[model samples]
Target: MAEVAIRGVHKSYNKVPTVHGVDLSIADGEFVVLLGPSGCGKSTLLRMIAGLEEITAGEIAIDGTVVNALEPRERGCAMVFQNYALYPHMTVAENIGYALKVAGTRKPERRARVAAVAQSLGIAELLDRKPGTLSGGQRQRVAIGRAMIREPKVFLFDEPLSNLDAKLRAQMRIEIRRLHQRLGVTSVFVTHDQVEAMTLADRLVVLNHGRIEQIGTPTEVYRRPASRFVAGFIGAPAMNFLTGTLAADGRIAIGSGAGTPVTIGVRPDEIQLLDAPLKGTLDFEIELVEELGTGQVFYGRSGEMEMTVMRNGGGEAALPRSGQRLFLKIPMTCVHLFEVESGRRIDLPPSRLAAE
Candidate 1:
């Protein structure tokens, strides 16, 4: 395991910068996930660390040594790409040991290493199968096993589970985390899926466009997003956004147009739908409802303002239905406010908001 340090890294194509000046540090044995939407430069940054892409300006040091000019093989990092990149003609065992064989590792020692990696990945029995015969998940495991066979100091994954189905992706996530635990190697994973980022990362580096947005533990980013983009992007079904101004009367003044606005964000789960209206409570016109087994999300509008409220299913309370008129109690403490102009979060005194 090794500590990976990135200092003021920048990358460009045709003089147009794709990765802005970015600095980050990965502790030894830490799993850091770079998460964002497509075209966010996360993969470019990961490739820079793997020596597949050149940094326009800045330093990438692996295990305390500068690796700016070093080749990929010399950086002591193993990468698992989004595509499995397995050789179709080779059996699982041959594919996993190819790196070692190319480097002139003795056949006996290489076979022993391959066997160990396969067993560790729970794919020992599949060693005889070719890539064509295996399932998507099995092929993915083979890709992982190949990377593991190298025993590199750092592990880099570029959306390694994107090729798998939903259930397989979920299963692979746990296995990847366990693999990191067993190997204790410095790992950097890039993904656009929030679920993957939340479940698999010790810390998350949220990126947008070509720059760093926010970097923190999953809870920190989810509970207290630094910006409106971070808040909206990090959550599922997206955080509900209501454009209005904080009025002097302690109410949000939402008009039809996007006027001078203060954006209010409400997590779906934090919204409470009451059967009767209470003082300070707002009205919601329920338009649709989705019950996704584990929970239910209510989609509706407040006047012209759209919102969603999430509630646990199979509960005692009657589920709110479409066409129903429900009063919403927006807990002040659970609400997030942002400056609409800059799309930056605005911190209001929680105690003060709660009291109002």
Candidate 2:
């Protein structure tokens, strides 16, 4: 395993910068994920670390050695691409051992290594099958096995599960997590999927446009987002944002189109259907309710903004019909305040925002 250090890294095409100056340190054996929307430079950054993209400025070092000038193979890293880049005609065994063969390992040793990796990946029985004969998941495993056989110090996965079905993606995520735990290799994964980033990463580096938005453990980013962008991007059904003004008592006064003040931004799960706290209750018109097995998501329009509420299994039964008026209770603690102009979080004292 090796630590990767990126110092003031920058990249561009024809003088138009795509990756702004960025610095990040990845610890040895740490599973770090680069997460962002498309065109955010996450993949470009990964490719730069893999030595596939040339660095326009600054340095990339692996295990304390400067590798900006090194080739991809010499950087001691293996990259698994979005597309399963397997040789069509090559059998699984041949594909897995191809890199070893290229490095001139003896045929016997290569076969042994291939078999060991295949067994570890539970693909031993499929060794002789060609790529065309394998399922999507199996082909992906062969792609991963090929990388494993190289025994590189760093593993780079660029949206490796993007092509798989939902069920397969979930299963492969567990398998990948287990494999990483067993191998303990330094890994840099790039993905646009927030759930994958949340579940798989030891730490997530959130990127925006060509710069870093926030970097933290998944829990930290989820619970205490550094920016409104991070807050909205990291959550499912996303965090609700409503424009409001901070009042004298540190309370946020939401404004109606006609200038009436209302409270804003209590997460759906945090909003309870209750009778008390009349001041925090808002009338909502239920537009739809989705049943998701263990829970139901209530989609409604509160004033002018659309709001989503996640209820743990009982919401559907109690939810009102479309266009019906219902009171949604907002607990003060779950409300996140953001500056209307700057789109930055408002740091309110706990005492002021705390629930009574």
Candidate 3:
């Protein structure tokens, strides 16, 4: 296990900058996920860490050693790629022990090491099988085992589960987490999937347009996103942003009106759909409804703004139909405020004003 320090890292391709000055310190054994949308430079940053891409500027250190000048092999980092880059002709044992064989470790010792790693990955029985014969999850386990056999100081995963089915991805997540617990290896994962980022990361580094937007634990980032981009990107259905004005009484006056122009942000799940009329309730016209087995997601429009509402485990009678008009209450405590012009989050006490 080793700590990773990234200081003023920058990258560019043919004079076009892709990764700006990014500084992050990853503690030993911590699982850090770099999250963002496409073209956000997350993959570029990960590649730089693995020494697969050269840094245009700045320093990277592993276990207190500057590794900017070192090759990937010399940096003591093992990277697992998304494609499960295994040799089709080689058996699982050979693939897992390839590094050892290249280093000239005796076959007896290499086989022993491969056996142990495969056992840990719960694929000991498949040691003799080729990757083509294995299931996606099994192949992924082999890929992981190959990395594990290296016993590197840090583990780098570049969207390793993107190719798997949802169920297999979930299972691999558990396996990877369990492996990290057992080995205590410092790991860095890169992905655009917010769910994968939220569930796998000890802390998330939200990146956008080559810059670091926010760095925090999943809970902190979800509860208190540092910027409007983060608030919208981290949640499913995204955060609902309504153009509005902040009232003198600390309440938000949604829609065009006279007051301080601002933006109100709230998650879909945070909005309460009131069956009966209440003070300060806004009218929402449902346009579509998606059944999610245990819950429902309603997509609709309120006045001129479009929004989504999520309800968990509501009975059939409670489900609202498309074209239905409902009342929505935005709890002040769950409200997020942002500057309309800058898109930056603003701190405000919970509004005391209720539905007027």
Candidate 4:
């Protein structure tokens, strides 16, 4: 296992910057995921670490050795791409053992190692099957097996499960995490899927446009987002955003018409439905309701700002339908206020502002 360090790394294409100067340190044997939307430079950063892409500036070190000059093969990193790059002509066992074969290992030792890895991944039975004959998950297993055979100091996954169905992806996620636990390899994974990032990462490095937004454990990033972009990007259905001025410490009046110009965010699950109008309650004009298996997502507007609430349950309980009105008590602690200009979080004490 190796600790990977990226210090003030920058990458640009045709004089247009993609990865702005970024710094990060991934611990030995820790799983770090680079998460962002398309064009966020996550893949670029991963490639740079693997020596597939050159660093335009700054230092990249693996196990304390500066590797900006090393070739991909010399970096001692094994990479699993989004597309399972298995050779169609080779059987699963052959593909998984290819790296060892290239390095000139004896046939008997190679075969033994292949068998051990295949058994670990639960794909020992499929060893003789070619890539074309295997299921997507199986092919993915072969690809992962190939990477494992090398036993490199670092493992890099670039959205390796992106091609699988949702169910298969979830299953493979568990497999990958298990592999990490068993092997204890330092790993860096890049993906736009927040669920994948959340489930697999020991720590998440959230990127926005090429810049690092926040780096923390999944719960830390979720519970306390550093910026509006992070607050909206990290959650499913995204965080509900409203434009209003802080009328008081815990109160916000939605609309540019009367309040201060500030932006506040709320997690969909944090919104609480009210049985009756309370002192801090606000009216929500319901526009839609979706019955998710775990709960319901309510889409509505308060004044001109749209709001979404993820209520716990599989049915219509505690939710008003379209064109109806519902009262909600958005807890003060759950309400996150951001500065209008920079979109940074603003923390306020309960006694700081006048009560509504």
- Best of the candidates, TM-score: 3
Please give, for residues 116-217, the per-residue lDDT of candidate 1 as tens digits: 999888999999999999999999999999999999999999999998899989999999999999889999999999999999999999999978999999
Candidate 2, residue 57: Cα displacement in angstroms equals 1.6
- Each prediction's TM-score against the native? 0.94, 0.94, 0.96, 0.94
Prediction 1 TM-score vs. true = 0.94
Q: Which lDDT tens digits does candidate 3 get at residues 197-287? A: 9998999999999999999999999999988999999998789998888876676777767778988899999899987769978899999
Whose lDDT is greatest here? 3
Residue 76 miss distance in model 4 (angstroms): 1.1
Per model, state how many residue pairs clash: 0, 1, 1, 1
> How well is each residue in 1-356 modelled by candidate 4, as lDDT tens digits?
89999999999998899999999999999999999999999999999999989899999999999999999888999999898989989999999999999889999999999999999889999999889998889888889989998999999999999999999999999989998998999999999999999999999999999999999999999988888999999999899887778764356665565546788788989888865788867788889988887888889887767888888874445456789888887775677788899999887775653354
TM for candidate 2 is 0.94
Error of 4 at 302 (Å): 1.6
Lowest-scoring 10 consecutive residues by lDDT in candidate 1?
A: 249-258
**Residue runs of model 1 more than 4 Å from their true location after superposition:** 246-261, 314-317
Q: List candidate 3 stretches off by more than 4 Å.
A: 247-249, 350-356
